[model samples]
Target: MEQWKKNLVVLWFGQFLVMAGMTMIIPFLSLYLQFDLGLTDQHEIGIWAGIIFAGNFVTSFIFQPIWGRLADRYGRKMMLLRSGFGMAVVMALMGFATTPWHLLLLRMLNGTISGFNPASIALISSTTPKNRMGFAMGTIQSGGIAGTILGPFIGGLLADTIGFRPIFYLTGAFLFAASLLALFIVKEPFDRAKAAAREQVSVLQGFRQLSGIRELTALFAVTFLIQFAMMSPMTLIPLYVQELHGTTENLAFFAGFVGSVTGLSNLVASPLLGRLSDRIGAERVLGCALLGAALAFIPQALAGTVWQLLAARFLLGVFLGGLIPAVNALIRKYTPDGMESRAYSFNTSTLSLGNMIGPITGGALSGWIGIQGLFILSGVLLLANAAWVWQSLLRKRPVRSKA
Candidate 1:
């Protein structure tokens, strides 16, 4: 196989392992808080859960751009190794947490070290053939989705069987193995002298350089909105499913199924859509996917049955599948070659910001506006973003405006 193909194959498994470990905590988090950490109050558990979950993104949002700039100067592969190994240690330490604060501290450390996803994206983007960028990104994305689809299921099962602490150990072990695999399998043909010869700037200077590019900045905002719109209603999904099902028995099972179905469809659809985008145009694919996602949200908002919601969620996944890779590809296109990794890192920061804000907004909005209203609001936001993409991207004109 070609070097690029070789790199993709290696990163695929690495991504899956890393992503699975990350998502594995989702199912058992509140349980762990209650059973192990001795958080007796329901209100306290809710607050801690929110804090522990958001803590990682908070630090990651602050640090990803810094990592990206470093990746541009050194190499993405180096950054990947650093993140993969560092995360492994942090994850394992979580298993030793004796208190809620311990877990919270570990979680924050995890976020500070978390750059695996964006680092891997930047590496693959820099290495892959331009013509195959979409396919590469799509396939890479599928790995993460596969982990997400499998993680909660495995975590739930493991927590029931071997207990929660061991799950973290297992997650840490998997990450270590993944990083080890990358060490031998993934290769980067980095020319650092050439990179060093280019004008180097402070991280802030680099940020200014990126912010100055109008289309890239627009693309970054679109990336943020894409994540915001998609994630906004997810925190309320289980409750929505319960509302539709109206039964506690098998409620968790049904909720898990509904959650996994979207990821399942996303995993299957991403590479296929990416291939299609490569043949046609990533912008068009992104535009269509945005519109399809906006439309798909309607069925979900109006879903009278859990099955209806599942179907809608699955369709939403299929449409939303192509959006990220398309955005990544477009970012790669618009970015200067030497600064590609930093561009991706900055985009990743926006994504982290979206991730942080979405659930908080969703959780709050569901209370004030109802679950269905949150869904509709997400749809409306996507619709507006689609229009924005249409005006900003499809017009085929440069954005000369200042940031």
Candidate 2:
């Protein structure tokens, strides 16, 4: 009913649709590369699929800060519209791809244009009340988590029923529809004068500004570590599931269930932990979640059965749910008022950086140290991260009180 609450509800759905659209191709990407694109060899399909997926992140990482600067200058709503519409068009063109190069180029372009999530986060952070910011962010996060959890399933169905190419068409259309809702419904209280004043600060100046804010600098590290910890064990999950469950009837279903359970629990827990953060403070919630996730990983590493691992993952999800929202809320709390968009964008880049590093480290080490070792390494990384957060927040206490 409230204005900020209204923004949350609309943007929640928009984030959901956008995330769903992006991930909808994950299930059948290799299939499309093989059948439709005529890549006959298994190794060739794997190589092209990795290239297509990694190409997006490579461009996305490079382009995010640029988009952040533009969002700060032009208004975050405009950035959101740019990403939404641009991505929609790019996605639709993928439906017509006749070669691997076509899909690869389109995906890279999509990444270069992709700032929808960060733009939405920046806009919502600026619009929401400071007290309720954690709650709002958590709720929005749940939408994306839910979408990520379900998109592959939906894409699989769409693939089965209508085939591969039409899946892209449907995803593109859904994206356009979500953007339409955002265009008409989501409102931001923009000030041209403020934007003009902000334009005076150059990009290097902005980075220097973040460096001067000790808490902001530390929080950025926390962001990267949180993502690294979450992603490190991800690539080994299917293998772990099979090891625990055995190759039985419906093995793929079990693998999918274990993969999704963490996100499902995240969907259930984010709003609750977010509200908790609002009451007790985001920093406290963040430290606790980091520690909780670390401990949860130990049980996961020790699990002898699929059900045990699933339970541990669900617990891990419950803690992991609290992290990004809390971190975002803290960023909003500490960042200079006019620089919120760029700050969040920088945070998103840290996320992308972690995405790149985590899986590589996990995969490389899994062979030498083994799959269980990756989980242990992740827990150690997270525990160290939790300590860093504790010290960082402690240092901020005196400065915050003086302010």
Candidate 3:
């Protein structure tokens, strides 16, 4: 097998492990706060849960570009290992937290060190053949989505069986194992001496240089909007499910299905769309996906039954699956050589920013507008974003794939 193929395979699993470990705590995060940390009030648990959940993304948004710069200067594999191992230790410490503050701080620290996913993207992007970039990005994305879909399920089960604290230790152990896998198996052909020879650019300078490109800047905004639109309705999905079902009976099961069904369909669509992007061009796929995603949201907003909402969300996933891989492929195509990591990092920063702000905004707005209204608003936002994508990307002839 080719070196790039080898790296892609290893990094795919590595991305899976990283995402799974990170999300494993999600199923019982509030439970941990209330029971283990002794937060008695439901209101207090809700507040603390919100803070703790957002904490990682808050610090991750600030630090991703810094690490991206370093990855460009040094190597992406090193950055990947650093994040994997660092997060391993921090996640383990969460198992030992004695207070809500301790858990919150640890979560923030985890965010501060989180770069494995972006680094993995940068690594695979740099190494993979340009013609296969779409497929590579899509395949790697599916791995993370697979992890995200499975993590909470496994976490929920383990929380009930082995208890919460040990799940942390188990997550940490899995992360450590993933890091070691990368250390031994993944090979990055980063030219450090050549990278060193290039004039060093500060993070701000790099950001400016990348943002100066109109398309790259537009791509960044697209990434932000994608996350923002998708994440905005995530926390409220259960309530919406309850509303649609008209009862709390089997609410957890129904909610879990609705929440994960999008990802399940997304998992199936990503690689298929990715190959299509490789043939037809990522820009076209991106624009069409955006439009399709926007249209899909309308049904979710209008659905009066749980089954209807589930079907709508699943359809939405098919388009949502195409967005990120196309964005990553386009980023690589447009980025100047030797700055790919930095470009990906900046995109990751925007992604984290959206993750951090989306839920808060969703929760805040849902009270005023209601869940159905939030869905309408999200669809409208995505329609506007689709227009932006059309103007910024599809208006230009897409770069042809190399023969």
- For candidate 2, the lDDT comes to 0.86
**How many Å off is the CA of 316 in candidate 1?**
0.4
Please identify which of the two predictions, 2 or 3, would achieve the higher lDDT against the true structure: 3
Name the candidate that leads on lDDT.
Answer: 3
Which residue runs does candidate 1 get wrong by more than 4 Å?
397-403
Query: Where is model 3 poorest over a 10-residue stretch in terms of lDDT?
Result: 394-403
Candidate 2 local lDDT, 1-403, one digit each (tens):
8777777888888888888877788899999998899999999898898789778877888888788888888899999999999998999999999999999999999999999999999999889997888888899999999888888889888999999999888888888888888899889998968788754577668878876876777788877887787777787888888888887767788888988999999999999999999999888899899899889989988999999999998999999899878988888788876787888888888888888888888878888888788888888888887888888885456345111
- Per-residue alpha-carbon lDDT of model 3 for 260-298, expressed as tens digits? 999999999999999999999899999999889889988
The local distance difference test score of model 1 is 0.87
**Which residue runs does candidate 2 get wrong by more than 4 Å?**
395-403
Backbone Cα, N, C clashes tallied per candidate: 0, 0, 0
Q: How far does residue 315 in candidate 1 sit from its true spot (Å)?
A: 0.8
TM-score of the candidate numbered 3?
Answer: 0.97
lDDT, residue 301, candidate 2: 88
Kindly provide the TM-score of model 1 when superposed on the true structure, using C-alpha atoms: 0.95
